[model samples]
Target chain A: MSSTHIVSIYDEELKYLSRRISEMGGTAEQMVADSVRALVSADAALAQKVISEDVILDNAERQINEKAIVTIAKRQPMAADLREIMGTIRIAAELERVGDLGKNTAKRVIAVQSSGMPRKLARGLEHLAELALMQLKEVLDVFATRSVDKAKAIRERDDEIDAIYTSLFRELLTYMMEDPRNITPCTHLLFCAKNIERIGDHATNIAETIYYMATGSQPEGERPKDDTSTSVVTADVSEASE
Target chain B: MSSTHIVSIYDEELKYLSRRISEMGGTAEQMVADSVRALVSADAALAQKVISEDVILDNAERQINEKAIVTIAKRQPMAADLREIMGTIRIAAELERVGDLGKNTAKRVIAVQSSGMPRKLARGLEHLAELALMQLKEVLDVFATRSVDKAKAIRERDDEIDAIYTSLFRELLTYMMEDPRNITPCTHLLFCAKNIERIGDHATNIAETIYYMATGSQPEGERPKDDTSTSVVTADVSEASE
Candidate 1:
């Protein structure tokens, strides 16, 4: 942003777009934290609040997209400028998806209103939430500062969230097996845990975007894919489809 | 794509992007079908083929994105033209994610190599795959034809996939409970089912993009959300976070 340009208003448009993205990042972070709280407490009211707040995140994304498109039309930015603007659109879209994940998680607070969640796993989920939110915050900073190193660090931490999620999946399975009663509520937590895990993924996606925007080169090498959710298939057969 | 323009090359550029997107969509649909074949047949080699083919989809998306941005920068397309290019970008991105889902589903073929999957569930997954691919095929046609009505119809069908997924979830859970040994494989199928369901979601997203591009207006009313995953939360209390 500091790269001096002849047209000051071009700079202004970019700055305004950045500000909207910042607002979106902040809202997404709050939505994550609040959704977890509502989940743990089964506070439907708080869950409702998280749902309503998603509109703000959506609005923020719209503003950023509109401004970015208009700026592109007006400035006809290429290479770095185009990448920078496209990066905002990508980040804003990721943030909005995060908002949806939060809303979906928050909705779970009301979904299991009859049976209580496993008390023991509450700490585990909170720990996972802390890890994901930390990642979200760090990625947002990377976006603001255009720090490739910071973006890479955030990208690497996505595995830690996945690890936590993998373990939680087993624990929930055990709970369900030990008592049939645990099945209903634990399944809810399972999906919610996956939601939080996916939030970490969005952060990683943003980190990649920031790195590409700054370097004009995508970070090389495959992203670490440690989520063992893939290991669930086995022997079966079906007639082939044309 | 057929509208004659003063700059014939501009039309050509847009057509090329569209052709790439169509290729991507076709490849993604094939990947889904192949992944299911691998899953049902427990054919790791076929799964590997599906996994390997994903690069084609990814490369298609990248090509479309780069070309679209360049066209916009050079053409400075406004209104419908701008929306057309942006829509291609959005659709390609969605197609890429669909490819990822297919790859992940294919990977499950390798993950479940240790044990045999339930024979009963293969049909369930194939059914889900059929529905999703059908939706994908229909939506791509909508994009090609620029038919908002077709897009709207595809959007409404998303709930049907969700409904099928919810039932499949129950069926898998029941299978797991009836036999503890079923847990591992059923869990894998559970993730696979969700992945297929998510493919339907990407199709719906593409439909929305088509709707917007054709009409220059986002469709009104809430998207049908019938996934029973939302009904899992209940009463609980824990120390809330700041």
Candidate 2:
């Protein structure tokens, strides 16, 4: 083949990979939103849908990885082109994880379906999910636009999700303590919330990948963190109850 | 440059990537073991050490990635050699996440530190951790030996970790419901167990990667999964109590 023909084929291959990433991102985003909605509304059907749809993201990741390896072998891309391909691989992996977290959340719906979540607790979780979804959406856009500035902004915003998760963690523990009946359902909700919190972290991971793809270096400094529930000790039951 | 000199350099590059992966594997294994020991014994100092050591794995992943990208750009390897390079990248990422799960488990040590976990609960968690660590070690060995049969075996054994984790999940929830005082520490232990289970999952992931690197095709059939904790509903507190 002529050099021009080879170049066009390579370009088409790259575009195909990008389109796949975009499709994976959309599916991941919807799964996150739908999982949280299922939790809040106790919609088993939606949760089941999210669970089955996860294979789409899983397959997308595997296909992108196969295509990426093929492109690298055939094109022997160097420098910027190589970085873009590597970035897609990493981004696709992250989105696949995001899908896993969503499926995990949906899987818990069955556990809480019978007991039903309290509105107050559901509201707290909903608020946290919204922030996480916002972060996910913004970072996916950054991936598409290759905007370092917005990516940086999304990285900083992760602290918001962490903070919300910490608070919700405390609330769930307190509720579980207040009534033994709440233990099983609350445990499931806590995991679901943790799943959403991790979704936010994946978005941050994608942002970092975008930065590396564009600038050829990792983001400066450590990513911010505020999820302190790990060290939290509710020693005073009375205080927690109040 | 002579053709032999170029070949040797290319060989050296590939060797360096393998050594890095081995180093990463060793570190991740140690982290998983140390974190579980810290949790079982409530050793804050050991937990702190595990937390600090995570950066080493993170840096190793980044360095391996950089070298692999350069090797591909410089050597332009094809077929099996290219698959080997991509395999290293995927393996490094999995090890990095295993390190993260270990670090997250270590972070929870403080929450259960003061209260001191119940001996029975600790034993249950220890049992689960042992299974997960065994899985991790086996998979890392498979990565080194490139044994497709061993990889397939490890993939099947994931169900063992999942089964143990599901039992542990029920035990922790039961402990929490039996006594309100156990709520705070039990919650932390629950998450710790979940983290270990995830470590096992990463090991299975590594096994799959090793299989792909060896055969250029994904393993047949869906992976065996028995972690029914997601859908578990302990509605009858009385039943859980017994």
Candidate 3:
């Protein structure tokens, strides 16, 4: 075969590999969502399913990596192509981590069940999980479409999750404070919140990865202005009120 | 320059870059240790010093990146050399994060001082910081030497840190339970313990990265073992005790 034909074959293979990776990302995101849902709802069956499905995600990751290696070995792809392969490898690794997070959430759900926690706390957890899932879906959309604007919007959603996490932390703190009996259950719920928050972070990481792939630049999030005038006044007022 | 001479120059430059990265790692590890010491001992001067020295670690990271890019563009490194450069980039990033952890600990110390928490709680937090610092030191040693055995040993140390974290959690829980007035200070200490625990996790991450760089194989840390028998026994014993 001519060198050009070989190059064409490798290009085709690269396209296939890229699509496979994106599909794997989709599956992993779903797994994470489902795992969180299981934890929030105490769906033992769903938790088990998520744990078992992890093998499929693992397989997808392995296949993507193998294809990348084979393409590199056979085609000796240069700069831009090499970057794409590397990005695919990194995204695959990140997606695999997402799958692990899902499995961890599922395991925590099992632990919480075994610990005999009250089920009423699941309502807030379910809300947090849904928000995290929305963020993951948006991030995957950004990845699939290479939508820079969408990626930025998804990045903004991280603040929403952060706010939720803060509220959840305070709520759980109050729960534990109300009674020592609430400690173990609240702790488990706190871990569930943490796992969901981490899912949001992973989605943010995907957004950053998308931004890098599209522009070869890291997007710096705008830092909150350090204008301390309001904070100062508030501190003084609180002191005066005290 | 002849191609051979250019290659020689590139090799030397790569070696120098790696050496500098290793040196930065050493500095970061030391900074973490001293920052924890300052926090535990309530050494205001040492805390201030750590906050200042963070700039040096930041500069080292910048230098490492600049050198890596120069070598990559000029030397045209092949696959293995490229992986080495990439590893250095990642290692530098991790080291920068370690530096940030130190700065964070120092900031927390200052915050605690400002809030006028009891000096006794600082002692417990100091022990937590020491545990974290020890784990980080071992992780860096493992990274510098690329000792798989050492990496495994560092993983064990992480368990000790986790144990300390659990006890610290219980201690903080007791404080918060004692009086609602104690909530703010105890919560601050809890955050301090959490920061230390997270620092230990970062160390473990670096250890995992080192294992990858040294062996070019993923470590098996995430697999769920079937310890059903132990779990059952423990469950029964706990039930009986309860």
Error of 1 at A10 (Å): 2.6
lDDT of each: 0.82, 0.90, 0.66
Candidate that would win on DockQ: 2
The CAPRI quality class of candidate 3 comes to: incorrect
Off by over 4 Å in 3: A48-78, A114-121, A220-242, B23-31, B34-79, B96-124, B147-149, B155-157, B183-188, B219-242
Q: How accurate locally is residue A44 in candidate 1, as Cα lDDT from 0 to 100? A: 91
Return the number of clashes found in candidate 1. Answer: 10
Error of 2 at B55 (Å): 0.7
Model 2: CA > 4 A from native: none
DockQ for the candidate 2 complex? Answer: 0.83
TM-score of 1: 0.89
Compose the digit string of candidate 2's lDDT tens values, residues A109-225.
989988878789989999998999889889988988999999998998887788889999999989988899999999999899899999888999999999999988999977787
- Write model 1 residue lDDT over A1-242, tens digit each, in one string: 55466468898898999988998989999999999998888889999999899889877877787788778877878788988998899889899999999998988786665667767788899999999999999988888888889888888888889889888877776765665555557777778898999999899989988998988766888886846655533232211100
Candidate 2 structure lDDT:
0.90
Clashing pairs in 3: none
For candidate 2, the per-residue lDDT at B147 reads: 92
True contacts kept of each: 0.51, 0.83, 0.01
Worst 10 residues of 3 chain A by lDDT: A226-235
Residues B1-242 of candidate 1: C-alpha lDDT, one tens digit per residue: 64466479888898898888888988999999999999888899999999899889877877787788778877888788888988888899899999999998888776655666666677888889999999999999998898888899899988888888887877776665565455556666777888899999899999989998887777888877746656632222221100
For model 3, residues B1-242, the per-residue Cα lDDT tens digits are 79899778888887787688778777777787787677666678998888788878867876876576556545556556665665676677677778876776666565445445556666767777777777777776676677887876676566667676766666665555554444444554555566677777777767766766666555776632311111111222223223
Locate the minimum summed-lDDT window of 10 residues in model 1 chain A.
A233-242
